[model samples]
Target: MHPLGTVLRSRYKIIHPLGSGGFGETYLAEDLDIPTTPKPKCVVKHLKPQNQNEVLLKIAKGLFNREAEILYRLDKIHNQVPELFAHFEENGEFYLVQEFIDGHDLSKEIIAGQPWGEAEVKKLLRDVLEVLVVIHQQSIIHRDIKPHNIMRRRQDGKIVLIDFGAVKEIKCLETNTQGQVTSSILIGTNGYMPNEQANGKPKLSSDVYAVGMLGIQALTGIPPQNLPEDPVTGEIIWRDQTNVSDRFAEVLTNMVRSHFSQRYQTAAEALQALTQSPPTPKSDRWRSLSNRKVIATGGAVLLGSIMSLYVVSRYFAKSPTPPNPQAVTPQPPIVTPKPPSTIKKFSQLPCDSDQQLSSPPPATGKPTWETDVYKYYGQINQKTKEANGRGLMAFKQNNFQYYGDFKKNKRSGCGRLSYPAKSNIDYYLGQFENDEPQGLGYLKLRNGNEYRGKFAKNKCQGEGVYIYADKTERDGIWREDKLEGSDNFSCKGSSASSMPTISFLSPKPF
Candidate 1:
């Protein structure tokens, strides 16, 4: 337990211990530097590495620093995310200071065995999804998304996402000479975590799955683990237990699909679907048009036009003297009304070729899969090769799908690599060589952050412009993944001219 009234760095004085976890302890503290009438309360997290081994300690320190940098980046732009005050190492232990939110976590409000109303559920989903959109856009995923991690702001009743301690970096696991797999640390709540996440391979969609579980728990008043799942499909069977509209059920179903490919690709997409109006049936639209009073009015006009035509013919035949050409008045041409064009139904709309509505085969088929390699080769007057052509490739093991030109079974020429349901750098579209990003290309991380410019060996190198999640741009030369110069990057909309720079610390030591 952290000692009460303990001051660190002669600035923040610990008021009380909030909680403690396996890796860290949290405390409510007051910032003494601000001599205002009411001292600002902040959260101080003490991160102590569990292992004394140097290698494990180094990894833990690197992860801790990386998380702090991520929080700093997000807090600068987003209001829902907690703001970082300061982070430092004291007595070989790391401590992070952040803005304390004065609100209760959702766990207190969301009680087990008590179902939430439809309107309340909808509001909850929207609020959380909006926050997630920002978190994901910043290329960060709140790995541990649960009722306890969400706080409802007392001032505005807005949902705030907290606790990014479990945030995981995008890295592939390794194997020893014996071909045995060495797993990465799995970091997610058990019931809320999807299969992929439980296996230590969480994607952006994994967060969506967790959110869906929350929704289900709210609606059914049952925990996710206790909810019954279909034996064959593995989908949670909660419709019978709850009374939600079919449309919302569909959205939730897609969100918590067993396969990541079938889930909403992003929080933005999920929010759009959740808020979208229900589609009106094509038959109902046609029925309404047919029942309209316009048809009766059209019939009366047609009868009137016929009678006038007869009267004009009779008068002309009975006339003693021929009417002068100039004296004959020209009647306005009778125009027939055209029925409305067939209402195009939603089902008739063009299908998204990339979207998989159902469970796709575990393996997407052959490696040399190209939809039209011959056409591409013919356009260039080159013969197509089995191992080389322009097409799409799916690497199931790494959860990556590549679409572009391939040479000798490698990603060559131009191509795009995407993680179908994950965030961070979601995809890279640019020049490729030997199955890696090379030369110039554009990279979009899952959190809406972007980088355009030169690349080498699958990393940002040379001259490039990096756009942060807050729409701030940094134009500089990059080596590996860090900016070259010591000059601080300027952030837009911020009073400070220079942003804090974090050194590039490698998670895996070479």
Candidate 2:
């Protein structure tokens, strides 16, 4: 390994070795100068060139790609993930630049014999849940959530999750609506792995289960790897800890349960309980969301159906049955009906305070619209004889629409947007990356309120516009779904800033 200082990416002056793993070695690097404020430092994870197994190499490359994807998704939301600095390949090798945290991975503490303190466990997990709030909101799942990936800083005593090398993202089933691909990274350290991941049903709750396992180990002074196991009976040796608090033991037991349905579901639910005065994590909502059984379509459409593997596939694989358009026989009416001067097919609907629009008309055609693959609006013809090179999956659900990809059979690819799409409704149609909106898209509201702008995983990230159907509108730069600045609105005004925001409400449908 390179000694104290080895320059990398030309700009990063390597300071010293931070850590090393089976895959690669990490280095502390300092940016030369940018003339900003304090000196900038980052981390460089460089793959080891010595490993020669081709199959393993392919797996490593896949993991590297997964890591990059995980970091990209994390950067889009409010998680504790480190920012990506750069990713490049050179000299038959690959490298990734990332934010360097001045902390130790919790693995270090675990190895050094971390004491089982209930408060300490709660504090660490509380922060992790806060981070999960943002992560789950974006539909991004860090399949490999373990102590080693969590960087606990010494300076501020805060946690910054690092090493996404083992992460697996949850694609919002759409482009490949079939759950064809389940990631094989198989993250987590043995005992910490939930049955879903081990038995292959992992989702957002998989990470929650892992975290809960970590908490159990921390609270009871039992190392997960070495936790007692009744081999003959196939039971965990946590009865003593259960004696401490039936509630805590019950939570831990479920967390490590072999069946996904038996484990904790959402981080939100567990966090809510863990953060409570006595740690009473709820199971209902978490279970509901977990049992959703999200799958990947070659399209990004989410057909929210929960069932066993056989049933789910049978339901999803059911081909579109073309309706007989010629079933209606013409009937003669005794009296001739005169057509009205104008056809008023749609009626007005309620709108927001300063908005106006019509609700979508009663159902006609199919209750659900399935596009072969959604491309840019007006870009891909829904009814195209020619299967263009491009492929995406999309479908409508109730008043909203959501999408993602076909990961072999698991949700993969990218861009799964779930936004309302009513006739005159103003809803968010966000451009997605790895399922959640990540680029530019649009939002339409029920009152004919429309906003089109840049989005970073569903939230407004850059310049956007809010327009009304009656010729009123507002356009401006957005930070987190909210607009920034003052400009000309019909009667209302906006606050202006460097980005120069503008906005106006509209009136139409009504």
Candidate 3:
């Protein structure tokens, strides 16, 4: 255990031990560099290889550094992720400094005997799914995503994901007859991990499976380990254990399907499904029809038929049976055409916005076209249209809004576009030409990823600085949104002057 009051790098003073796991120990600490009334507290994690063998230790060290890099990048892009402050080796162990979150882990809230209501479970699903979307987009999987790893922030009640300690490549060394070593490692939690993950071939959907298990646990009040599964199909049999809306039940069932193909492919897809309205059941539709309307229609039809029959009979009696050579002509029964079924169209989710393009009026300053465009577009507006001066056009829908300068009715000069509602990207403050992003500007995505540099026709092009979510910056030339010939600039939080210079020493034999 790290000594209490012990200081690292002459800055972070260890307060006390927080927790320990198979690979490392964590501690609460205070940053002495800042001269605030009360020094800010932070978390310090010590990463030590479980195996002391030289070959295994070397591999573990490499994995540890890589994990640090992942955490650093992810923190920059996601608010829910913990920030990495510093990472360095002390003695034989690697230590990481990170922002401290004062809150209780979700395990405390999800008690074993207490079940969460539909509303509570739904809220939890949204909160966690949003974070997963960012994580998956970065190509990083949180192999371990249980209640213990999730914390509810006391300040804002936001769910914060902690512990990237499990984000490492496992190495299992094997010796052949010729004395050559080969290695592989499988990583995941038993109850939450899917078959693919357990087989060491985890995909993005593996994380989705874990989240589904979490939802099930919340609803059933039973821990994942205690829950039962089908022996042949391997699907979780959870519906019988809890009472939830059929829509939510269907969603959870799809999410935790035995086959990854049957599950929601991505976090965004899962989120859309969660927020979507469920299809009305046939029985429920009949219930929705008004009883009075059905009775009134039936009564009207019956009375009309009786009246027609009486009138026909009276006419027949008055005219008498006319025996004629012509046989009674049989008329075709009245046929009523059923009204065409109206297909219900569901509203598109925010994630679907990427497929849609907003088309404003052209450079023509005609009032009629402008008004018509506004009416057709619904949310578009000609905020300011001067004869020859720079004009401003605005488009807004819900939380997304765009204000740009227009020349000859086309987007020109600088513009600001905000899309807080989008799941993929956020706002773009940059140059525009012909209503498209062109020249230089800054683009900030919702996942905390940002690019500052040249853009052409709305794609990242030419020289630019791409800052990843983990706070790593890459400076290079980009083509069609792809970074090319790029090199790492600098770690965001660490500085040359403040960071300690280190020289590796020969490893002591185990």
Poorly placed runs, candidate 1 (over 4 Å): 167-185, 291-510
What local lDDT does model 2 show for residue 302?
42
Which model scores highest in TM-score? Answer: 1
lDDT of 1 at 135: 81
Candidate achieving higher TM-score, 1 or 3: 1
lDDT of 1 by residue, 2-55 (tens): 678888999999999988765568899999999896898999988765435555
> Candidate 3 lDDT, tens digit per residue, 59-100?
666766787888889999999998999988766567889999
lDDT of 2 by residue, 175-276 (tens): 224634334334455877765677655677877877877777767656777777777755567667533466556666665665567656787877776655
Model 2: which ten-residue window has the lowest total lDDT? 346-355
**Order the candidates by lDDT, highest first — what do you get?**
1, 3, 2
How do all the candidates rank in terms of TM-score, highest first?
1, 3, 2
lDDT of each: 0.67, 0.52, 0.66
Model 3 RMSD in Å is: 23.0
Instruction: Provide the TM-score for each candidate, comma-separated.
Output: 0.56, 0.46, 0.53
